[model samples]
Target: MKPTLRAALTSPFVVFTVFMLGKIYLSWFVIFESAFSWLPLLTGLPTVWAAFAPIELFARKRKLMLYMIVNVVFTSVYFAAIMYYKYFGVIVTYHALQQVGQVTEVKGSVFSLLHPYFLFIYTDIVLFGLLLTFRRTFRSWAVRGMTLNRAAAGLIFPLALMVSIFCMWTNRDSINEIKQAQHMGILNYELYAIFAKRSEPLLDESEITAEAIMKAKGLAANPSPNYWRAAEGKNIVVLQLEAFQNFLLGLSVDGQEITPNMNSLMKQNFYFPHIFQMVSQGNTSDAEYMLNTSFYVPPYGAAAQDYGDRALPSLPKEFRGIGYEALTFHTNDVVFWNREELYKALGFTRYYDKSFYGDADTVAFGASDEVLYDKTVTEMARLQGEGKRFYANIISMSGHHPFNLPDRKKKIELPDRFDDTLVGDYLTAQQYADYAIGQFIDKLKETGLWDQTVLFIYGDHMGLPIYSLSSKEHALMKDMLGRDYSYPDMLNIPLIIAGGGVTSPQVFPQIGGHVDFMPTIANLAGISLADHLHFGQDLLNTQHNLLPERYYLPSGSLINDTTIYVPGRGYADGVTYALPTGDGAMPSEDEYKRALELLHMSDSYVNQLPKHD
Candidate 1:
């Protein structure tokens, strides 16, 4: 072979090999401990190969620089948008810097563009872009390198084919196993490609149907004594409080209270101290999906966006069928997640958003909690006076990110010991929300609808990180939680169910998720849920045990419930707390296997949900 030709052929391959090794290294370092296997490497080969192809064409410094610049710009922007939406609940802006504490040079705005996370994301994008740009390079190398002899070509082709086939067959089970374990939507396309190549049959509809039916039967067999049976034709009001944390109950100023109304209301309500939300996606829309549909969000994308065009089962549809007029109110932009479309898909009769209210109603994102609550009550009364039972969803926005309010905002006094700028502001916002709820309840009572209404309230998710309370103010939270105070506290929120004239208050100890709310409410309202094989069980019924310690990430599943953190491959049980069998220990082989099965089942069921037509 000519030297130039040889170098041309080998250069791209070498770069490609280096890239793959990097991926393997990173995967091992980060994901491997979580039970991830080699499947990600194998499935990512096409993109990896494509990324290196560019090295042959744009091998020159000028071209490479241009390519790198373009790649970096796009990747940085894309990831920044994603991070902003995911963590901060808004678009990226100059003002975001003010929200984070300890902004050193490394954490500076310009530095954030080149942050490690952004580098990882950009690497993948650039790698894939190269692979796509260099298809001709591969074809040229393959043709020039192969022998002209027909017999030689025949022998080499079949040998290559046979080896490829053998490897695929050997790895088929492992690949399927990994795909089944992944819960993140971002990786689904690659996983689907692998399954398609192997010609593995997708999950069967009948299996899902059977699982749903069995779950329904089990639920019917064990009903909660506290379950509120449908009052033939009563109004139902659901208040989904955005970022309402249970810790707010402990918040105070100057030995006074922040959430006095919420604290008082809790005394009259059935509160679930350990109720967990099985949110499919980590956004507001995901919470809505779990609450309304009682179905897991497909791990790969936004359920609301994906199912916006498809028909799906919803709580409002059931309520409407039973003589209730259904409405949804969001004190924010209706178009935020295509929520207007989603509400229609969920069978809501009327949808109200910021556009429906006055300009003075505006809060941080949209309407103030006071304005939203008052408007909702007014609307409910109008509907009630029309001789119609109502099914209304009131989604609050005041307690959302930036946690800011007008300076004149009602201040809830807090103890001197609990004084901190951000935490104090956050507590004040919670107090404001609690005040709104109290006012709404009072309006219900005044209208004589308190006894005839069923009220359900829960947090959308955890409070956004309070930069002021970082390691300095919340040192104890970090010490006791074993995690940064930011992460775990963000996941803990309050869930309270009251009204329908229940005289006694009780606390539910079982861990339940938002998805469980739908079926539980449906059961109370005498509506049969369409899909019973959901990850969420009826929280009202405490017969089932708590959910295993599992965190479903966009990439894969983390089963941290057992003392060890078992990902997909092995156990890290000894790293944290030991398992019961104890050796200061690792998860038993059986425990790892069971965790794998549960993750697989969750993935399979979610992937196989009937796509809206």
Candidate 2:
């Protein structure tokens, strides 16, 4: 018998209710197995009712098809949320919508995280469709008269909206975005995203008075006027590496060197062993912006997309002041991630992207590192002959995630333990990356520009995750390090200063971030930034270092000399762990307070500023 109007109202709603709760449980199981927060499951009921409530007006076939469509959309979102959480350790936000350009560069890493098990989310709809399509008896249910169930329909919309309001009120003071997201559930979070518009400003715009600037300067290190800028008039060459972490620096397998070129350069240049990445949503672009401006990245979307129109005060602008032409070179199209506008905001004299180089060698979805360097050096040489002082920013890409390279260029012979493993593939690609960068350095020397140019070589961000490793691999890594490898180790990237007048090698043992890049470079170039609204300190002169973490870690988390403190939900429930050891302990209150202050001030400064036309 065909089901009645009452059956239509109640039947699919029951199935949808199951799908809704099941998906939430699945999302929980994926991220933290055997652990869950039940509130989102409970809170999501109203949304399910709201969804199915509108279905009564349509015929049964249309209703079933529409319900199947809803399942598809939600399944996709929850699956994306699962993948996002696995990689970033945070709930995916609406801001990620703008990051599609990055998918091509990071697909290897992304695809690695995804497994066939994710298909379970859609199984309910698939089974429902199959049952209806194959069974002639079930098809009778599809022709249920197009009738409105006023009693059921009248209640769902109002109840959903009202419950959503209650969830919002309950989560109002939950300022921690992650905590708030968990409490409200997926459907409610999307609603919150719409209403919240943006986060509340951490500080009043009027509070950035002279005293605030004085307080900011007080929190940072006092720089020696010309301690580092002795190479004031030299040309600048900066290498911004992608997914290049410091773990592979001295790593060797089967007695072969992983990075013979960078290893040799660190012996004679200024190498920072403790610099951490501080990029926000912009990632690589954020790194470039921070390296030049000494300013915080926008807390929301990428600065390239959101603040690309602003007249950003940057290193390029500083170079332009002294008759130097500032240029940047990337292997991808200049328009990727809206970088063309970013270059404009940062004031680059010219940008050399894919259009400038021929397609002889391509890797990592773009031109190879070999092409990037050869063309960049050739152009720099021409500019030098033309008597143009230049600041050339070169961004490298070969060592990017999913780190697999062409088999011909795979030089490493991995032990059976690492064969076909993520880390093993990463090492092979990095070896190639090292070889490419080495060629560039050699060419610079061959052209006699090595001594005349000051090169700042540094990593853009962390590439690998400890969670991606198997137990054996993790144990092997621990054995290699002779200790527990944690956040500090994973986030550490190489920062080298070569050919800038120092006769011997030196290593800065202090911790720093990209925020300090311009200040340090400015000091070396004899350009003072004491009067500017800068957040970073010159690491060359500081004895104490404090850096607040963002993006990868929870808000209010910070790193100091001996500890890396990551909060559970907020500052009150935070845990501090010793560096490289992963031993839990209490953090220093004074330094931690200072770090939070810096984060707040930076957020305040950026958010309160007006966007330029």
Candidate 3:
């Protein structure tokens, strides 16, 4: 073979291609499992080459070694994305890249998803290293006269760009990101997401005007509370449960209840079993942002990371306006997801995070819920003694992902069928978290604050990821749910509001999301948010509600009165499921339009908020 041809065959470009192909190949197997398509896999090539061509063309001989290093770095990104998507059901973005530093706290969950097969992407690097070490054996690459000229390498950029752009334009209509990733490949899908986000117009002042607020308020159903503000002047405590889904509320295996405390609480409170979580890329922090600000998460990123700098109009600020002190407590450090800045933007009077909670009783990520509630209640008692009404946002961390708690912390015993399974570990951890919550309630009653306080509890997001299960485990969960696990099942979380002053213990079957919490809670507190530019309506007053699920689900997936609509490639190709049941159906075209309109308005509203310090 000619020296130039042989040299080209052994170039770092070849190694980079091999690494990326392995990445796409391994990711495909991990996601769809045994699903094969050559064209889809081939499409990952042009974009990878396009990204590398410029870097290579501009660098000198000294940077030749750096090429292999860069190849490793880029391949690692896909490795991380594949591992994340296994449990998250969503792809990580460039925005998520900024938050990678925060993964140390949740390394437990990260390591759980990793497998030995994940190392396949690195095999090419090993091969390249071996070739370098044994240069004499590979004469084609080690030949002194085989050098790449700038003119010859210049051809790669145009060839790659043309192919990459063609892929993007052809797949522009692919709205379902999962399908898009499958069809266009990961490299192309990422480029597609970048343009999709950049093309979105910012929300303007007109979108948040008084007239807009009135129009949004008109969409709500008439108020039907037995007595409005029944618990006015009382303390408000909101518990954000980590990964606690609605199915676990009354779930029993072998006659052993999974969440006995919550099951009992649901009977005496307003239980909205149909409420779905609306968190975006931020996950738990997104839940907090939604509940406080009543805004949609940014189209492509976590609201906390994307909008933390803006002065947000929030539940805490509204409570402060009503002569109440507001504070939020979480077990994690304040710097995670830039929460210290986010809390300030949300108008929190004070935030008590990891430093305040200590390491008394630790969990997967931080301090245990047992310690969180204990410390919070102690502070609440101090405020109660001072005759002050407070609004407290408490975030629980015990039921986090990987759901593996020590044996001493576990309370529920699994049957023989569930031994050492993800489902079993989840139940044990959630049950213990519930037990801690039950303990907190008892402490409230013991301190005589139970009757004088109005409390709300909700899961931050879904517990079990649909994609994380083995066939046997999936079958077990399917048998328990009586159907295939789906978007509705994945996003459905328990929302319970209970206290002594909640005179009527009723079940509200209306569909809602995190967006609705601030409005609903405000209405129950005798504070009307009708004048504010909020995305959610009061569930208590609204006869029905429909909210879009952004981030975790497809962009167009939404929860309504009795169904969840998930777009396939786009609104044209989507699936719908009956609420609280996994039964499938064909959603009408009008439903599609409504879902689109809701998403557009939500995006517009958040974009319109004034940028702040």
Candidate 4:
């Protein structure tokens, strides 16, 4: 070949080869981090480069620009949506963007934009910069001779290579940070996709039968069955208090309790004083799924919304089978979590939301707790008077985020601490809920229906941060609990079972989640649940421990006894000196392998459920 022709062919080839190598380097970096090992360095680099070589030939300036722009924009928008939903329980759209400026730093920008979801955007930006450099070099070469001299070229490629290697070295550390942040935010979509595709057998009849036998044998040994059996024919009412917490349970102003009604009710109810809710995907709706369906939320994606049509056995369904008029009442938009569809599928005969009752006097996201409770009580009485058994789930709205209540000065007095502040306002709302609940119960008593009614109340999720609160408010919480503030505690709302006939108040000690309510209540009411394999066990059943088993997408599967966190490959389990485990360490390899097998089995079971359906 001629010298000039040879150089022309070889120059682009050299740049293309370098670019290909860089791409290979990036892929290997991801693999290395994913594997949690340097093992990928030995095999992935050269193999990936060879596999990607053809794409290098087509790398042109225009093509590179388009690719960079698309990836950057796509990734940025994707991450922004994730973050927006994480903080506000809503997505960012063109209409939402218009209102973005109205929100404060903590509420909108700082809280939403600074989250780990933004890391994906940052990764996209880095990729864009790399693409731009390649594009600029190619453009310069196409117009004239390559701009970099032999010395510059030698320095540039080697420098790029070195930096690329350095990035690869640190990628694992970076991913660890990303994983922590991602877990705190919304569900991890990529992780869900991985496990969903791995086909495994669903829970077989033998397994369930064995588990049932174990549960039954254990239950027979307990004396609480009589209390549970006596709970029949009582009207069951569950109040899913949005963003409530035990902190609120103790919160008092000037020695006067904020939740006076709750305090009084606690004295008369079967309260699980230290009950911990085992959550799946972090969201109000997913909590509802866990609480109602007793099925595990697939750690990534919108499982509640995605599985809306899936046949899942629920408490309402069990109640309906026993001649009860099952109903669900929500203050917010029923369509928000696809609750309208999901509720009906779960066998709620009558569904009520903002549309059902006009939104003119609604508070926060929907109707005030007072109004919702008043209406629900009225409906419950109406149904009961008609000689029908009733199961009504009333979801409160006043305690939701941006915790604002409409101006209504009831007979109850607000404490001096509940001034015009966010936390104060939130407390005031809780007070309102307590008052409404108290009134509802009083009305039931007037009708002589109090003895025949069962009341269940718990929080939906944790409260969001109130920017207006002093650093001291945040500090008090952190000091009392040595961790970053979370919405989960707020989600850990008090669950009380109260009625005139509820015998003695006893605190159940096992760890139970929202999902447990269905099975627990159903079993107590002597209702059989068919077509659903629930992950939640009855808390009232003292035989089997309702262990908290969490499937954290992309990495870990945590059962109360063991936590298997695998950022990448072959797997390593260590023992820790934590409860469940004697030394707060991870399990041994043999233990880990066993745990992994169980997780795989669980995943297989979840995946196979739909096929059976």
Best by the TM-score measure: 3
How big is the RMSD of model 1?
9.6
Using lDDT, give the best candidate's number. 3
lDDT of 1 by residue, 547-605 (tens): 33332322223223223232332233123333222233444555444434433454465
For model 4, residues 1-613, the per-residue Cα lDDT tens digits are 8877667655543443444333333332332224334433333333332222322334445534443443444344445544554444333334344334324412522352353433643553575477557776644443353322445444444554444344334333322223322221111222222333333456564565324533422233333444455567777777777767766775666565777877777777787643444443335666666667666565334455556666656777777777788888887778776676677657677888888666766666666766777777777777778998888877776666655555672334555444544556666667777777788778778776677877777776556442223455565555444654443343244677788446887766444556567777766666655455665556677433323233222333333322323333233422222332223455445444443444444444555544212
After superposition, candidate 2 runs with Cα above 4 Å error:
1-10, 33-40, 43-46, 53-61, 101-109, 131-167, 201-206, 209-226, 467-473, 580-597, 603-613
Residue 388 deviation, candidate 3, in Å?
A: 1.1
Provide the lowest-lDDT 10-residue window in model 2.
139-148
Instruction: Give candidate 1's total backbone clashes.
Output: 22
Question: Which tens-of-lDDT digit does each residue in 222-284 have in candidate 2?
Answer: 634435666788998889988788877787776888889999887788888888888777778
Model 1 spans with C-alpha error above 4 angstroms: 1-61, 64-201, 210-220, 223-232, 413-424, 465-469, 476-489, 528-535, 546-613
Q: Arrange candidates by lDDT, highest first: which order?
A: 3, 2, 1, 4
Each prediction's RMSD over C-alphas, in Å, is: 9.6, 3.7, 3.4, 9.0
Task: Judge candidate 2 against the unseen true structure and give its global Cα lDDT, from 0 to 1.
Answer: 0.75
Cα lDDT for residue 203, model 2? Answer: 86
Off by over 4 Å in 3: 1-20, 32-34, 48-70, 130-157, 194-196, 207-227, 581-584, 588-590, 607-613
> What TM-score against the true fold does each predicted structure earn?
0.66, 0.89, 0.90, 0.66
What's the distance in Å from true for residue 576, model 3?
Answer: 2.4
